[model samples]
Target: MSRIGKRPVDLPSGVEAKVSGQTVEVKGPKGTRSFTATDDVTLTVDDGKVSVTPRGSSKRAKQQWGMSRTQIANLVTGVSAGFKKELEINGVGYRAQMQGNTLKLNLGYSHEVNFDVPQGVTVTCPKQTEIVVEGADQQLVGQVAANIREWRKPEPYKGKGIKYKDEYIFRKEGKKK
Candidate 1:
């Protein structure tokens, strides 16, 4: 038995959850998110809560059972409270700006990088160096932040590049003369 799978997911007020066959959909004040469970896992929603049960006690079944439950729970919480990712630019010439529904970044490259903001997701910059990404789906918000960070990952030698807020990058000393 999986401990996480055995736990029931509590639906917050104003959030609705529906399970149909292999797919589960959760709608909240922020937005709606849906996910399909694995074939070995079954999902049921009732009485303001959700549950996940495995078809058998096999190892894979146990793993899937826990994973499916966690995923569903994340979906519910994401739609209710939403998700956010913060990034900081740590170089002299590095900066970012929002143009229309796109983000324009200058990461010491010859040409600027432009990324389109997907629907249901919002990006904001309180300061030039700080960027925040918000969305109702945890997976999507995280993936978008990762893609932006990949454009200019922090370097070890100078520790200058884009990185998540509160992230630490080890710095290397310059070569001896």
Candidate 2:
């Protein structure tokens, strides 16, 4: 009954998927990733595609059906093409630089904010104001970008802070003179 669950995730060329118990592992040229589905849903990889079906007609089963399918799809996409997120700093003195495994941030704060890059995720600063997060895990890449953005979220008035490349901050009018 789940729309997303009904569609099978097709494996791209040169990508391989293996099913072991409730877990599905995908391997590709970029990297390898795995996902474990809840018991409420059954996972299967056949031919060149993966499918998910609910074990019963319960709410939890249906919930897991779609979620499990998406997770599996993300695993495939992640291993194949990987994932990336970009952030931009928009303040006068705000900037970011990478020091080996650490990301040094100057977000107009009293002291510089040093963000330690976690395993499985690569943080790079192509420009002083641009940050790029890359990884095979979609969640980790997104979470790393979010954590960096949290240091200095864009303000509504001047919109001076860090934000995603495609994000738009709503501006508010200044106080009356």
Go through the candidates in order and give each one's C-alpha lDDT: 0.92, 0.92
Q: Evaluate model 1: give its TM-score.
A: 0.94
Tens-digit lDDT track of model 1 for 1-177: 788999989999999999999999999999889999989988999899999999988889899999999999999889899999999999998999998999999999899999998887899988889899999988789999999999999999988999999899988898999
What clash pairs does model 2 have?
none
TM-score of predicted model 2?
A: 0.95
Off by over 4 Å in 1: none
Q: Which candidate is the best by TM-score?
A: 2
lDDT of candidate 2 at residue 10, scale 0 to 100: 99
The TM-scores of all predictions, comma-separated, are: 0.94, 0.95
**lDDT at 24, model 2:** 90
Worst 10 residues of 2 by lDDT: 29-38
Off by over 4 Å in 2: none
